[model samples]
Target: MKKMTRYRILMLFSLMIVGITAHSEPYEGVKDIALRRFPWLAKALVFNVIPGIDGNEVFELSSVKGKVMVSASTASAAAEGLNWYLKYYCNRSMSHFGDNLNALAKLPEVGKKVRVVSPYSHRYALNYCTISYSMSFYTWKDWERELDWMALNGVNLMLAPVGMEGVWQNTLRKLGYNDQEIAGFIAGPAFGAWWLMGNLEGWGGPVSQSVIDQQVLLQQKIIKRMKQIGIEPVMHGFYGMIPSSLKNKQSIKVIDQGIWAGGFKRPDFLLPEDPYFDKVADIYYSEMKKLYGEDLHFFGGDPFHEGGSSEGADLAASGKHIQKVMQQNYPGATWVLQGWQQNPANGLLAGLNKDKTLVIELFGENTNNWEKRHGYEGTPFVWSNVSNFGEKNGIYGKLQRFADEVYRAKNSPYGSFLKGVGIIPEGIYNNPVAFDVMLELGWHVDHLDLKKWIGNYTKYRYGKSNVNVDKAWALFLETAYSSPEVNQEGPSESIFCARPAIDIKTVSSWGTRKRNYDVAKFEEAVRIFVTASKDFEGSETYQTDMIDFVRQVQANKADQVYASMIDAIKSKNAGNFKSSSAKFRQMILQQDSLLSTSKYFSVNRWLQQAINFAGTKSDKANALWNAKTQVLFWGPDNNPKTDLHDYAHKEWAGMLSSIYLRRWDAFIDREFAQITSGNVSEPDYFKMENEWVKTGELYTLKPLKKRERDGLVKRILANNQ
Candidate 1:
């Protein structure tokens, strides 16, 4: 009787343990991401989490009874395994522009168990500027897709400084600062990146409390989703940046960081030695923990970022004190620093605990700072590429250079501290191929042959490999995507996006107008790419690429017209000038029509996104203003001649029609009149631009029908040829 009673109790306990294990699904988040993105495939997929192989994330792919099985050591690895199967076996993929994740009739059989293991300790994504340039007005829906893509691409660490406004607001409130003073500290939605970097303060703001609260909620959701997918959120760290007004409030040693570019005053640097510094930092971290959980492990901030003054301070002590406060709040946290243009100074390095720090080489495409600085003075660092600036529309990436550099870094003498690889584009909206190749390098142990890789990329990117498509990609490899040993910021600047000038060398201040690749060769590739359009009419990815390629050819032709018009101006040929100027204006209008065929290149879509994110009427107005200003004048309201104007220029459809078109018209009409009848009047371009921003007009247009779009492409190609 006693033995039977003991057996019954043991059985009950065993059953209870089974119930708990069944409820806890470790791979559930990744499964949900797969389902939400590729609903058809998700239902036929099986996921299982197993132990890691030698402390590195691993995934095994196979097919069992017609269902795709992905067994991984972690959720992120499972998502990557699912991506690999989709790309290689299924011939489907996702990108920033569009997705090719259509339903398959049947699951493709993985005949053998295929396994992949990432060699890097960390895989990171995003830039501080990406917060404004690519994702300033992102809603939860946008974030959902962003995080989903991150998981599939194996991004385990991402910079996410989204809701710092609320943190600052609460921290200031606790420190006896008024609402008005706090308002002066926070920047607007479109300009938060600069604010967070300590380059400027209150330039685009005096934001409503409602928007602040909304961002706080949005950040909460973002962090929650990221944690589930196994991606660490690198929140903004407090690095002694205080308002310039803080001097009037308290007696403390403050270094005046006088001014930044575009005449904006930089925030004052608080001496880390001051007692007030510790007090303020404690409150700041406490509020941050209250808002975002204490489970955070990484923080990103740079002292003296982007030419800010770090005058009259002990560099070594300041660095140590900053990291000390951070460690005090969150034990074992890593302080992530940007290695760009003489940053993470040697003195600062001398003070840091190397084990608790990670540096990101921000300009790997153009600079070999890692080698130059000896792997950031032996501190753990990630090799990174900042391929695009301001998210400019250009077909540019040194595909071979990317592969060569990553391979070189991994095998270099300083390889011991080379922690991982990452993509830190100022804008992540363009050049999807560049990012895909960079991220996938983490999984590769051997150096890649980019030529063969391009063929495979073409296959998965468009859902099939055609002879014409393959030929075009080869031409692409030699032309725009070619790795020439030259220093260029992004793809060649579009002449159409340039602010109207007779001798314009670049569209933005630091951008270039020179095409380093062969324009004719690029055109030939576009020609061949168009030939496969008939086979891929139903593929969204193909259609989008077709529009983009054809658009590049149009931009090339605009450069020719611009040169002819300038030559006419210099030679005093009024008739030639008139014809060339008219042609340029007509091309701008035509380009707008061409871009209208895709929402990806539509300015109306961007504005709509900004408007849709706002809850109140006032918020809507502010959001719209923020959106328009950012892509155009990007201003300090008072500085009309600010060199920062058109720094974040876009070549979108409605933007050309509404903003650039008008600017060109004003300039051209005046120039033509001056040439023909000696009437000279300079247009107040800054005033004209600001007026356009306040119009509240959305230049919405229906996308052209397929037949119309095809005809437009053909017309453009023929005219350019």
Candidate 2:
């Protein structure tokens, strides 16, 4: 154990005091998030508030015949408190929305009062990166369910920037921009994350007025619901990100933020010293208050996000000025900055009042930017882990590393700067084990024995324990999810998500397309997982996860087949190339068929959400195009060989058969034709890719029957043998 300094010990005690004092009374304010998320439990469960529990997020549970008593500080916390009690004490748990619990057939009997207190003041969730890939097109229905999940999992703070476009539009309009100009300022639904980060401007637009207005209403619902459940909503702040044409439209001094990937125009930054800076600030904040209200205490924004030009500007002054406007509008507001590469730069942060700033270490799962920079020069930060990107389907996370890093950061010399820990994945659908452990760490102030914890997690994740399942998880921890190799950002890009390539290097721009784990071990884990399918067939979480693990094993084998084809091509072996290519196609088709068994893995469902949000024929076309463009070929249009093709690709049933498999088949057939003719005709990949992206065609998805899916999964696992 590391010896703590006097300053550190004192700070820890002070934080404990503050945290304990904050929870004086029980909070029974769980609202729509409860009703929408845990509809079964919400109705039957009777909750109460308990003051002075002596610990953070502490809840007392006692149950009668048909009624359950849950006492906590807030109803939102109470919901999680009740959930924790259910999972640990009663042998019942809810892992995800629509996830069934066999125990849900009957309520639990907590014979005596049971209490569990939270260990941390903050338990945060999500990253700005999550907004675009996993949730950009989300309506209130999606938000409602997600919020409920957050409450159940004990998320007290969340980055909830649902309707930022409306705020941007109304602010710009007050600054003399017309309707057409306002439309240009707002990016489409798919690009909200980067747009809010000031990375790009109007690239995926012309957004309709109706959409913007609808978002305003949507945000109101999100914020209100968040407040009811003891969760504090963090809104996006105005930090000098004006439209690309705002300079030409106004006399303000705006900096050209340069261009991003695929030649997209980055948003221009309004200089803090510009005479109209205060005027726009006043209007933007006023407009935000009018729509989203003034109760928000956290604001998130960063200028020059990712790659952008800020060569001449005084960033220190800019940071101070941005915080000035935020603090003025929402007094004592915590300015949330994405703690990413050299961002919230030393000189920049030097100017801001650090007391009101919260920096999220965006990639803490891989990079230790917090310790490397000495905890953002003493400003408060949250240790966060971003284990996924673009919501691309792949099983990956540093589960043990998540526990290790959070524990170390909490005890390091600069630990005082570590306000708390959070889970900030670019997407949240994959790797439920990673999230479970990360959230559990928030309540564990002591070091975690992962060997012991994994057992509890396996028990609760499936609602019952089976030795085969536990062994599979143990193998999983040793293989796919726990490999200790540093690859480029996010999960290793799946070949199933890649556009057809002889030598695939990346699926998304800058994403590393390489496997770093033992393929055989992962397959063995999947095989072990499959044996329990019959035992846990009724469990949704178990079935969904079994499909995912099987899909990963098949995809990895499919990649090997792809490599063999590429190898054959390199050696000019036409016969071998044909054989290997055929196998690659077969592997993808098999994986697709296997994925169709899970309801959550449907391409039709993913696409329909985009379609459902459309208001007009043009709106529908553009909306659908936005959906396809983002996931397939995120682009700037002129360049046929855009490096950003297949950036956010999914390995769902329809996408595999229709898009990726089609592309691979085209590539293979072209090569075979050229080889036979000896014509020296080179295949035009860009043409086929562009043609595919331009077509707003939705493919047919055949969802399999339970027994049919089970049989297919069994057959798929046999290939691994």
Candidate 3:
């Protein structure tokens, strides 16, 4: 009876294995597309192991024909591997998944049960925000968009490292780091923008401990979801940088990053050679393993990301020490470095294990140093673009260069070391098309028809199928998407107050204003934008985007008029000044209205530029002095003993004082001129005008009465309303 039971158990286990394998086949046509687009990548990575027809679908592994099916566990691993391959090679671009999935389903050999995983929630309200301490995770809707992109382009690996703060806190505490220290290390919620930039440090904190704890739980959920979809998670790794509190208990050398000029001490950098380094590394990794599990193969961290010191140590040796500790703790671990701003010292690559290191050529579209240096002497590298800054809304990119460079890299002598491509923007919300085009490039290395691809993209992005929308996109491609020679990181500047808006008389860093922009081309682009806006007139997203686009159009128009005025000023042409100032003021007023219309827009930067332009154009030193003072109070970066409400009162006082100073000067000059002319009416005129000015001044000085103060409060609050 025991022998019979054992035989039955063996048979049951076999059936279960076969059942799991039966359901885990790759989508039909995925392998064919993968092989055709990325022959080298497919050759190295794809592995097929099945040949069967359950219905109309066919099953194959790594392009091979077989029936040695994949179990659920094996399928999950394969998915992760695929994701890594896609991100590393393709740069996490997006594509049309709905059409691709439908096409896959229609294949004669594909089974009805096989379906690509959906990362979206059916209800939009419930999934609009990703629940996490870190806001980097896409909300369910965004995740669905990403998943659709992934499936269409055949991405199986994804890096979902959202909500990792709690994991770090728990780990640090185990290693004897205190709450104060941990708090200092973590960034404030809003400043995640700068934290990602490797700029600014813990400016918005002391973060609540509850937030950290919440992130830990959230990360577990994120990892689980990613796993189910066959995407791999790349967790944060320990580099030598840490919170200043670590210095108190651990004997490690620290470099103060100095105050970032915003009244906060920057995070300190720890030296890798310190004896305490290993202890910290162990605690960090051990904690990561305990919280997220040890299944992850890739880790991301960088030394001296934006700016830091390697003053006392050998740069090469220091890098090796850091990598050595990471590898010792997690075997076969991949060390991911961002090739940003000359940090990680090219010298450091010499000491690190070449095969285990991965370099992200972070600004590939803008910089070619990674390829030029040949991955700093043969370290594996991937091309990437930071296409956006501060994730600001605007449309711009080196479209042709994106295609040209990727092709060049693939055909270069150092091509073998080029692993893949990626998009690493500080803000990922804008530029939907740029992201789509970049990711799709990974799936198609040859015979790329960009126009057809964009036509499909237009339908998918708007979540609709419309002919008019397709026509609008074609116009957009011809205008906004057309490549320009300017070495800009993102879109053209708007005349709005968030960015500097100088008069044409003043040359910007890019040289002459006329040379900076092509007015004729820009006008055409604006027309295209207006036409596109008509199609999505009622869309909230479209309207929000239009607000920025319209301002940019206004700025471009102002630039042309301003340039002509500046030339007239230089030629001593006085007639244009009044008209020029009126145009400038019109631009300012237009921006003010836009900013007032929504809480989203701010005009601080524009105000500062106006002040700068006034100072440069006016000959009188006093005029320049007044403009500078105005900026100090009203500029975006101002700190007048409190927040915006307090600053507004102070600004009103400053403006009154400035007007009084100008009036006082005029009074003295007028009295002198009247005395010189020997006119008796002069004394009477001076007395009358001076008395009126004094009355005006007295009215301004009358201390704010309760009712008056209440009115002011109402007006201030009304700005938001």
Candidate 4:
């Protein structure tokens, strides 16, 4: 009998407790998730688990006595079967946009058995992440709907970093840090993911212990739900990332990760070469096991993530030791790495054990890194589509390219490394078609014809089809959303969401405002899409899309106004300048009004969720500050040195009329005053922007019926033309 250490003793105790309660059935929560989202489907359909090949989890459907039947080997594959019945037979469908289901109607008679076997073992979701920006404050209620959305779309592996700050809090305190010191280390709800990965640190601090404790409990619930639904929740792994303050005290060799996004202190990387690294990694896992339990299999963390300093480091040794630490505690675990922006470097991949590692080819839409890097140097990888960056609202996706690329890689020489496919939007709400089409590739055996697929998609999307809607989508395929003939990142940034400038370089710091598609042709498609609005007026999905499309049209029209303003300034004509400025201001107000009609476009909903996330008044204020800053002026707070302003800018209703409009109004006033007086005047935008950041502004958060935006969409379309 071997003597057990204290941590080892706790692990055994936990195992004994967990053994009694653990259920081994894989597809446990398939029905519960379905009932939560679509209760009516329970009466119409049935799901069961059956044994099959590992990657080839199968879902088969049959009909008897007017009852639809389903048999699936996994929860997600079962949901896919439910999805198939919803789309092909019943013509009722589910999408990221919304659902189109008619409970009163009967399922179409299934004469032939409809069976779909997923070819890939992994179909994943999220980035590292704008889910923080878009939905950090999301409660279990919000998550219930989202998890249902994930299951319906067949997302099996998801980045569920909901409450990692709590883990960090407990982990650090046990490592000899005071509560105040620990508070300074953990970021707020908005910046939790980035801080966890060692990119930037302590920008959104000092988080309270109560919040941290609350989050630990919340994460337990999130993981439980994820496991139940057959989705493997990827939690933040401890890869020797400690606070920068850990230097010069302990004998441990801590490599300073330095600054990221200008002047924000990056967490010091704990050198695996140092023997003290094992101590930190040990306690971290011990604490993690206590809070989250031990059934977890996937761990996500990157050391030199997006410009972390790599001095005093051995790359190969670091990778090996990090993965070793993770495997030692959590047996037979897979290390999930981000294949983004020169990450999982040749040396890094060389160190990782091939069988136990999986790399997310994150920028698959833009870069051919997997092929160039020899499928992450022949290590197993997922060919993922990260279409949306920062979750900016844009009607853009490389739809045909996604189907083409995923299929092309599947049959390529290095095809064995291509283990799966995924939808990795930094934020997920925008581009329903982009996500819908990508996830479907998991079940596909060959190349998909997006042109033909759109016909079926439109029918299922709106619960029925219309000739005009079909024609509009035909034009859509060739224009607005057509895969760029050249390389493009995400969607065009809307000028309405941009900081006020006549010749704005880019909407976000690194993003472009240039429309890659032919604007005029896309406008024509929008006009045609609106023609069939009455038929799809009942569709929440269609109406939601219409409002989004109309907003895009109006945003595109603002380009002409911007051009007119620039021309007036160059020509030194005050009359033209005043005229263009007024038109620009009016457009902002109209855009706000149009957006207010839709629930999804409400800024109030976002900010209010942030406020509600906190307990006390001070925490609520802090939460609101963090919320507003992320979407409007991404911050290090009032500092002129920060270049992150407008990085995550949203073009939502309340945001437009409130912050953006106010900023533009001030810019136009100062510029108009100067240009008219025969003097060139440049407004001090940074000064004005800094002042706005400190102001306590709030937006209304109320839901409205889609009908409110009915006439408004037409008016926007009519005026833009």
Write the residue-wise lDDT of candidate 1 on 1-721 in tens digits.
9999999999999999889888876688888987798888888788887888788899999888888899999888888898898899989899998999988888789998999988887899999999998898999999999999998999999999999999999998998889999998899898999998998998777788999999999999999999898899999999999888888989989888888877889999999999999998999999999999899999999999878777788999999999999999999999999998889898888899999999999888999988998888899999889989888888899889989998999899988888888999999888789999999988887998898888889889999889999999999999999999999888788988877887999898889999998998899899999999999988988989888999899998889999999998778788999989899988898889999998889888888888997889988888889888988888687898787888888889998887788888888887877777786878888898899889898879667788887888888888443
Query: RMSD, each candidate, Å?
Result: 2.0, 7.6, 14.3, 5.9
Between the candidate structures 2 and 4, which one is better when assessed by lDDT? 4
Please write out the lDDT profile of model 2 over residues 503-571, one tens digit for every residue: 878777778767777778889888888888889867888888888888887777777787898888778
Runs in model 1 with CA error above 4 Å? Answer: 1-19, 719-721
Model 1 RMSD in angstroms: 2.0
Off by over 4 Å in 4: 1-28, 53-55, 678-684, 687-696, 701-711, 719-721
Q: Clashing pairs in model 1?
A: none
Candidate 4, 279-356: lDDT as tens digits: 889888888898898999999898899988777688888999999999999988898999988998888888889899
Per-candidate total of colliding backbone pairs: 0, 4, 25, 0
- For model 3, residues 1-721, the per-residue Cα lDDT tens digits are 9999999999999999999877764532333334444343443443343322222112222212321122122333233334333433232322311121111111121222232221110000000011111123234444544543444333434445555576667767886877887776766443443443334555444556654555466667666655544445566677776666667776678776654323445566677777777877888888888888887876767666556555676778878888898898789888877677785577888889989887767666678876668656888776767665433335566656677777788677887777666666544545656766665555444535777776655544443445655665565565556665555555554322211122422211221222234445544544454456546644444444445445445555655555554555455455564456455545544433443332223322222322332212331222223223222222122332211111111112222233322332343334334434434222232232233322312112223443443343233223121
Full-model lDDT, candidate 1: 0.89
Shift in Å, residue 66, candidate 3: 27
Ten contiguous residues with the weakest lDDT in model 2:
25-34
Q: TM-score winner among the candidates? A: 1
lDDT of 2 at 398: 86
- Write down the lDDT of every candidate, Cα atoms only: 0.89, 0.78, 0.49, 0.80
Better structure of 3 and 4 per lDDT = 4
What value of lDDT does candidate 3 attain over all alpha carbons? 0.49
